[model samples]
Target chain A: MADTPPLLKTITIIGPGLIGSSILRRARQTGTLAQKLIAADCQEAVLHRVTALNIADETTTDLIAAAAQSDLVILCIPTGAIRAVAATILPHMKPGSILSDVASVRSSLGPEIHALLPEGVSYIPAHPMAGTEYSGPDAGFATLFEDRWTLLIPPPGTAPEAIALMEAFWHRCGARTRQMTDQYHDQVCAIVSHLPHLLAFTICNTADRLSADLQTDVLEYAASGFRDFTRIAASDPIMWRDIFLTNKDVLLATFKRFEEDAHRMVKAIQEDDSEAIMQNLQRGRHIRRGLMPEPQN
Target chain B: MADTPPLLKTITIIGPGLIGSSILRRARQTGTLAQKLIAADCQEAVLHRVTALNIADETTTDLIAAAAQSDLVILCIPTGAIRAVAATILPHMKPGSILSDVASVRSSLGPEIHALLPEGVSYIPAHPMAGTEYSGPDAGFATLFEDRWTLLIPPPGTAPEAIALMEAFWHRCGARTRQMTDQYHDQVCAIVSHLPHLLAFTICNTADRLSADLQTDVLEYAASGFRDFTRIAASDPIMWRDIFLTNKDVLLATFKRFEEDAHRMVKAIQEDDSEAIMQNLQRGRHIRRGLMPEPQN
Candidate 1:
């Protein structure tokens, strides 16, 4: 049997942070993601670390030069910087090359980036549906995307060949891929990721604002319940801030629905209506258990 | 050197659920908490499981008989049933025996149970800051409380010797012990445990209430953030319902504070106030990282 060809001839990963570094590591370890892996970051220190780690075929601080030579360029930066970074490199990208990103929010990103693309350069945005509380190059591992879903959002009118190639690329990096419209993607992610993060972040501040003595006790005696929230709470501030603003409409609507449900719970408790409370709790428990077979932490 | 004697001659655990069975298992394994472990439950099936597991020297459905001969009787039942159970067992409790409970709420529990104490009997309420999203006898282990905090909320005039004995008992069960007023315990738990569970349960329901297709996708692609909340929401509904009502005032107040913080986050995102959003996320991340040395999930 003949060996399968590499997914792409050359791939450049910009802003080689956690997700980006993990991709480079996977490509190096598997020897299948790209024939040559190029890592580009604005930070000299990050390039130094990538070179020292030796997970990439080459490292550079010049993103435009890297984009010109690569068959694909993935912007693994924060959501706020996606458009500017895309605009900066899209012009230099090879005529037949693809441009993609790993931003979490995708509501208006598709149209915005679509407008910036040069004639022959195709764009496809993806979200890997995986992460940790930690970030940066040192925190990544080759298996970060293993068994995780990577939803690919290719703007309408994008070439089918480009979409298929991107799916193959993610699969080689150890992810399952699916296609969805950007609008639907935003709504799904709002409930699954954004609202949960909003609650976790808000709860931490609420605990911090307690009286001094009570605050000390809250941290000291932080039980399993609060501890889980804090784990989710400890994520990159700038990245999350950008996500909140980028997906503002969907996130706010999700929060309103959650607030109304929470108010109903409060009323049930206040009225000592055991049946209503029990029904709500049971539905939540059943739905959760049905979806996730194993409990995480 | 002479071996130290068991903490008590007989320790009767009323209700062999998760917490109750865990105590029994610890006592059986360590052989230090009690010389004779008596397990009592309203359900005969639970008693059968306790007998089959051999976690108790004796298992019974007779609460009064178990209390009459035991030097310590701990109620490991729901918060709503604590007062009623105490009322039933106090009259039959041996003279100078200690009666402690493992209820999470403590605001009015101290006074309400104190009024039912017998002449020579002591009442000490304890809240173990540990659990999984599981219930019943089968979901327990001997090390469930290892390195965990168990706050002891003794009534105003609890005997020092009695308090010390209960503290020693919990220590033998692999838990650290602290003494706090009922009011303070409730406040601390409202922020740390009760309020977290409330948010988790509410978020699960919110996700469920989405459009059918969206709900399906939310569960199918349930990311790490939502998965953690679901793990918490999977807890026993009856147990959590009782907790919400029992800690009504503090839980409600904490929820209000959290809601205000969440609204502030929404406003920041709406106004596109990047600085404000960044600051909130950073503060939450900082506080969370400062308190927990390691992430659980």
Candidate 2:
């Protein structure tokens, strides 16, 4: 692996937050993505921290300057900000450079930005299914994407070389990669990721509204199941808000389906129909068991 | 701690599944509950396994025989079956002995059973706020309850000695104990534990209804959030069904509130109201951070 050449001459990552800094750290640690790693963020304080961490060969708050010298520019900011950031940096990107992003939602953002890319540049959207509840530069780790999946949504007619390079880059950073359409990615993620986060947020709000005395007990006695939701619900508010807003149609569609299923169980419980309740619960357990991956190292 | 007297001479745990086995193992490991640890289950194979593990000083298929010799009897079966099991064993419980249970729901079950205990015998109810998704006897460990909270719901005017013994017993099992009424335990657990599990089950079912290809993607791309739900959804079906059935009223009440809150978010998303969505997500994060316990060892 070490004998293989670095995939790019230089790669700049904009927005040195959880996902951005993780990419910086992992790419540098592996020495496979770029010969020179540059970090860029809107906030100077974040850039200062990036410089101190030494995960990047250079750090700048100027996205355009950072993009000028790089073969690849990764926009790792919120979904809502991706287009603005991409437009600002695209003018400075050299011809033949690849522009990519790590936004959670893609259907709206990916195609819109891909169509706006200059003729000589390529755009591919990637979503690494990895994170914790925490954010910011310090929250990142080199192994954040280890044993996780990274979805690559390349625009149609994209060159094979660009696709291969993106695939190899994520693989070097410890993620398995899959290719799909941006529309399909949004639909699939709405069910798997977006709906789940929405439910967790709603559930937390549900507990939040408990009568003051009961509220105390709810927090004090939260067990494993609720604790897990709390961790997910505790994720970055603005990131999730942007995700929901960008993927609104698909999310609302999936949530409608989820609410129907949830209400079915509620009705079963209300009627004291143990058979229906048991059957629904059994189906859930069966599906989850079948989907259980072999234990990862 | 080692020099302290055992809380009771003999303690019998009926239906030695996950919680029951953990209690037996932890109590015996600490030597603070009973000198003679008795295990009772309907399955002879489970008894054989328990005997081999030596977690119990004696293993019995006969609940009556186990209860006849013990100063304390704990029913650890499903919520629906607890009353039946209690009736059978209460006939054999010695005078002045305490009858207790580890059922999750309390307002309905605990008081009803506590009222039926034989004269001169005591009844104390407990709900241990600890568990993993796994079940069965071998799935248990002595540390399952470590750093967890256990709620003790003693009936009004109950003997202080019985309360003290139960408190010390759970403490020996590595839990801190808090006292509350049975009615209140149901309300608290309904919001925190029961509602979360129901939502997880429903979310899993929602994914189960997806097209076969998308279902595969849901499993493959289940990032930390959905993955957490899958683990909770994979919990024992029979156990969860019983909990939902027994705690139906409180659970339905909580679920109604949750559905209302969820729909509010759904409307906000559908309308592209970013501020409302962001506000709800932020509130969830704030509540979770405030309630996080000191890091467990």
Candidate 3:
């Protein structure tokens, strides 16, 4: 491991938020960035904190200046802002530099951002399947991505060298990596991540709208099951809003499937169809048990 | 306190399942039952395990023999079986004894079981908000209920002495106690526990029905949000089925509310209404933050 060269001489991360800060911490912990690290954000306060915390060698509000000297630039901002931020940085990006982002949806975003890159620059999209409900620079830690999967959505004709470099970066960051088409990435995440967040958000709001008396009780007894949903529902709203908008088509399709499933189970409960209810529940338990390596006895 | 007497002189717990065994473990650890601890179940295997574990002073398949001399009797069985089990034990229950259950629903069950009890015996309904996804006697532990809430739904004319005794019993088992009307309890739990479990079960089944290729990706990337739902969905199916059946009215009403909320959010996402989407998501986060006494920064 010590004989292995650093993945990049200098890496510039735009947006020192939760995921970005975690990347910085892990890189510094492992000395993965050989020469320098630059942190860029729109807010002076955030940049000030990043510098004070010593998470970066350089800090700036100028995206282009921060990215100009780096061999790799990762956009760790919201999906909606990625286009504008990447457009700002592309003109100054050096030839042969790698451009990437950590956004949930990538089908359309990958191609759009790829077209923005200089002919010699590469755009590789990655979605790390890791996070807590908390956000901001202080909420992150070095091990956030440990034992997590980070899917790299490399477009067709992506250079083998570029893919290999990005995969190596993720590996060094303690994440298992897989390369997939952006369309398939969105589809898989639509069912697993996007739909569940949608359910948790809607369920939490529904409970909020209950009568004041009942709402109090709902919070009081939340640990019964609702607490799990609320933990997810407390996630950054703007990030999720962008995910819903960017991944609208795949998510709507998944929502339709979920509605149908909910409808069938609702009817079973309404009609006192105990066997149907039990079977549906049993299927859920069976699948969940399969998820674990050792099924609970 | 050591100066305080044990909550009950003798107790019989019917159905040594998860909650039942947790109660047994907690009682044994705290020395809360002074004279006798009887474990009664129709299954000889469960009774055998209970005896082998030394959790009970006496083990029996005969409900009458177990209840005959007990000062308190707890029906820690599924909701549907409570009526029959109560009927079996009522005729043998000592006069002035307290009879309670650890079932999730109380509206229909309370009145039905109250009707089954003999004139001198009192039936109090209790629900302890503590559990894991696992089940059975082996899954139970002494600290399962520590710092968790246990609701006591005492019907009208329930003796002050009876209420005090049950409250003290729950306290000794390491749970805070609250008393509420049966109707209110059903409403609160329907929104918090019942609806969340129903949603988890239905969502897990929906993911389970995905195409094999997509299902594999879902399991691989589940930590994004689906893992939390699966944890709830994996709970004992028979226990949850009985809960939905017994609490059907309130749950159906809550489901209608959830459907409307979900439909609104789905439309928002489909129409690409970023403002509406953000607002809905923000409301969820706001209410979730409000639930925490010390909100996460």
Best-fitting candidate, scored by lDDT: 1
Instruction: Give the total clashing residue pairs for model 3.
Output: 0
Between candidates 1 and 3, the one scoring higher on lDDT is 1
lDDT tens readout by residue for model 3, A1-297: 566677789999899889999999988788865468899899998888888778888998888887889889999999989999889889899988889999989858887877787878888887889998888888778999999999999877788898888999998999999988988999988988899999999999898898787788788888757898998999999999999999999899988998999999999998999999988999898778768854444
In candidate 2, stretches whose alpha carbon ends up further than 4 angstroms from where it belongs are A293-297, B293-297
- First chain of candidate 1, TM-score: 0.96
Write down the C-alpha DockQ for each prediction.
0.76, 0.73, 0.81
- Give the range of the ten consecutive residues with the poorest summed lDDT in model 3 chain A: A288-297
Instruction: Give one clash count per candidate, in the order shown.
Output: 0, 0, 0
Which runs in model 1 stand beyond 4 Å of their true positions? A1-4, A294-297, B1-4, B294-297
Off by over 4 Å in 3: A1-4, B1-4, B293-296
**Models ranked on TM-score:** 3, 1, 2
- Give the chain A TM-score for each candidate: 0.96, 0.96, 0.97
After aligning candidate 3 to the native by TM-score, how far in Å is the CA of B153 from where it should be? Answer: 0.8
Per-residue lDDT of B23 in model 2: 88
- Of the two candidates 1 and 2, the one with more favorable lDDT, higher being better, is 1
Best by TM-score: 3
Docking quality tier of candidate 3?
A: high
TM-score of chain B of each: 0.96, 0.96, 0.96
**Candidate 1 lDDT by residue in tens digits, A33-82:** 88999999999998988888898989988999999999999999999898
